[model samples]
Target: MDFSLSSEQREIQDLAYKFAKNEMIPVAHEYDEQGKFPTEIFKKAWELGLLNTCIPAEYGGSGFSAVDGVLICEALAYGCMGMNSSFMANDLALLPIVIGGNDAQKKKFLTPFTEEFKIASFCLTEPGNGSDAGGIKTTIKDGGDHWIINGEKMWITNAGYANLFVVYGTIDVNLKHKGISAIVVDPKSPGIEVGKKEDKMGHRASDTRGVRFNNVKVAKENMLGKPGEGWAIAMATLDHSRPLVASSALGGSQHALDLSIKYSKERNQFGVAIAKHQAVQFMIAEMGMKVACARLLVHKAAWMCDQGERNTEIASYAKAFASDSCMQITTDAVQIYGGYGYSREYPVEKLMRDAKLLQIYEGTSQIQRLVMARELLK
Candidate 1:
């Protein structure tokens, strides 16, 4: 198989890397400390066509391939995943439109954001259910000509900042997965309330909150696909998003290895550079290997998506393996620094914090394992 990137892909990667280093890196720490969203950075990204990379060209987007999406995500994540997530959440929010939205729905919801540069979000998790997603208790009751939604979504990324939301709720509680329905909601709707942003352990810069829908009236026309299609829609969205999550993890691991190697080369111990010590050399070597392997998985999944192949199994493998490797590599980076690694002054501590959410969100490491196994056995 040809693994080399096309010229277009290479150019996009270089642009993303340059933008992250020049624009994002300088402000990453400040935003992390303040737990604030960087509107200016997002606006710049939107201006650069970085924010709406996955939307179709006819819909006023760059129409980048899936591999291009992963490449851009990796570079942006190299600077900061918290900020990267704030940007990448657009991908999750727009997935339903790309996957199943009718032309009018796409034109009205997807096109405006791509052209006007507004943020979007996907709402799936609720306080009672995340990995057991089918347990979501959010309910949508039919009203004459409109659907009145009354439910609360928890840990919603981009909740406060998003202009549009692709939300899912159950239309019939007795039907289990078959009762689920997906719809688009405007944030300014009369009954929509976004709670205070949650104080998170990591990815603090990304907006997270509880969103309450209180008798919010949405036209039946806003519904995506047919009722009872939410499960299928949700799965399709994850198929595209999982690889992007893996790419973010891969970037964090790459940053950790780079920092560890640089420090080992310069730090002196027992009258010699730490890099000269076999133990230190071994640690870096192991971390490097993990990063390389994880990257391969990420790229392979992205390539599969570009080929128009259904990549559920490979996507699960990449997400599970890359997230686990990132956590290990970042932790090793901290261990290599001895006491200094634990200090907030060092970048490894930040890497450790950022690597954690990779395992928790998008689907936990355990959930990914289950998905991979189920697909493999079938």
Candidate 2:
């Protein structure tokens, strides 16, 4: 029955929001306009223990829980989701290692990230693959003392600046999911090429590009679990990280609501404040409800993850509903702002554009529905 955040959670929330207000909000538009990654902001966030918060203390990390992660994500996304994506991609890239790596593997791969400001990219979706992970054409083969990888991964976030890449490939394309394996790769390895940065429609502040592995060599010890176990590892990674996506979307929705409420009260329309109009009130009310429900769903999923429970269904529910709702909420906010909302000078326009990628990534709303259906049938 208690809905309050624990004292620890509240303190985490305060620290995150303070950083967001001080650092992210002021420069979000500047970076977005230039389509540049916020390196300074990221360095500051890292200094504050905001970036890469989940690696265990033994590995020189804070070992924060899933709920703690959601709180930080929401606050950062509220400032700017584009910057938040750069942060979230680290968690996305690292989750597979935490879920499937042995002690030695974890120590070797994850420890350096904590020691300094670094970035990583998750390499799963291919040039021809988006929702269908099993349809990937990438290949990873056994070499005598090492592993060899060859593939082109598309739509990889933080690809341009990543120091490390977590790659997924198949031993035999005919075997599909059964042939899949996950391996960690050094981006500096020979035969690796990073394509030109993509000119994206939104989240322009995050570096994204295609990565081609001609014949990349990786240490044999870098593979996570056994050869056929990658499919499960990928699935588990999604289940755990989907809520983080939901939290980001939730933050965007809350931001849209806050902006709308402020504008409605200040803007005079027909000789009175727009807040006095019933039509405006209705839209505002709907926006408020969307924010409230989405927060509940987002938090529930994150809570389940921290408890080590099976949350595949709830995670999908949160990611789908929260992201879809964020798009709606941002769009409606623009509507309330009328002509001004469409212009780049105002913040809502960027939010509306940024809100879009949330639905498209981390599993589209349609894909999440299918996941829910499959789980229900089982």
Candidate 3:
């Protein structure tokens, strides 16, 4: 088993991290404070082929494997997870098409994204339920020439800014998962209402809103697979996306640890540098170990995905462990910074806020555990 990155992978990693450092880091705090999306940064990233890395090469994307995709996510996320959400959310929105759409569908829906910088939202979560995807209240019905959709989707990332939306709805509420369908819809359609952007606790720089669909018309050509296949497509997208989420968690954890280590060496306590103290050393030591272990899990999951293996169990492991570790590591980083970390004047506080959403989104940490349990029992 080779542990080292290929030279090309290293180059990708370096470029992403450098872009994050140079472009994202400077404005992350301001964007977070203002609760604004960093459109210019996203434009720069898209131009460099860093934003839409997952669309197939045939469609003009970088065609990076899952492992390659995670590497880019990790490095960019290291700069600012909030800003990184805009980048990562693009993959989330596009994955359903990549996973389930036919070649022609890909050409029509995904090709334009690779050619130009655009935003999209994965509309699965609803006002009724999030983790219970089958419980979504959104409804879709046949309209002969077009599919008519009516419902509300909550906590939709990139909703306010999205040019397109991959919507999930049930044809029959009684059928639950069996009745679900996935359709790509243009947000400009009549009866589509994009709510005001959400005031989120973290990832504030990412555009998240509630989108309401009132009999919105969708092209049949935009349907993903046959009807009633949306649930499977959504699950498959989540399974593929969880690894990138884990990698992003790894980025946040690594960033926090770096800050903690730097702060510890410079911070003085009781006549000595905090780095010289055993208590601080122990926290830093545990953080280092946690980051390393989480990275392995993330890479393992991404590697499995790249190998065409179904990784439901391992993806859960990575997502749960890495996101939980990120929350812990960022918290510890604040502890190390000792009061200043609580202030917006420091970066770790923002990281702490951002790390939180990692656990909550892309399947919550508790949901990840249940997934692992189900896989094991099965």
lDDT of 2 by residue, 1-378 (tens): 767899999999999999988888888889999999888888888888898766878888898989899999999999899999999999899889988889998898789889889998999999999999998799998888999998899999999899889999998899999999999999999999999989987898999999999988889889999987899999999988999999999999999999999999999999999999999999999999989999998899989988899999999999999999999999999999999999989899999999999999989999999999999998
TM-score per model over all chains? 0.98, 0.98, 0.99
Candidate 3 off by > 4 Å: none
Clashes of each: 0, 0, 0
Candidate 1 residue-wise lDDT at 279 = 93
Say which prediction, candidate 1 or candidate 3, comes out ahead on TM-score. Answer: 3
Every candidate's lDDT = 0.89, 0.92, 0.92
lDDT of 1 by residue, 278-331 (tens): 998999999999988888999999888889899999999999999999999999
What TM-score does structure 2 among the candidates reach? 0.98
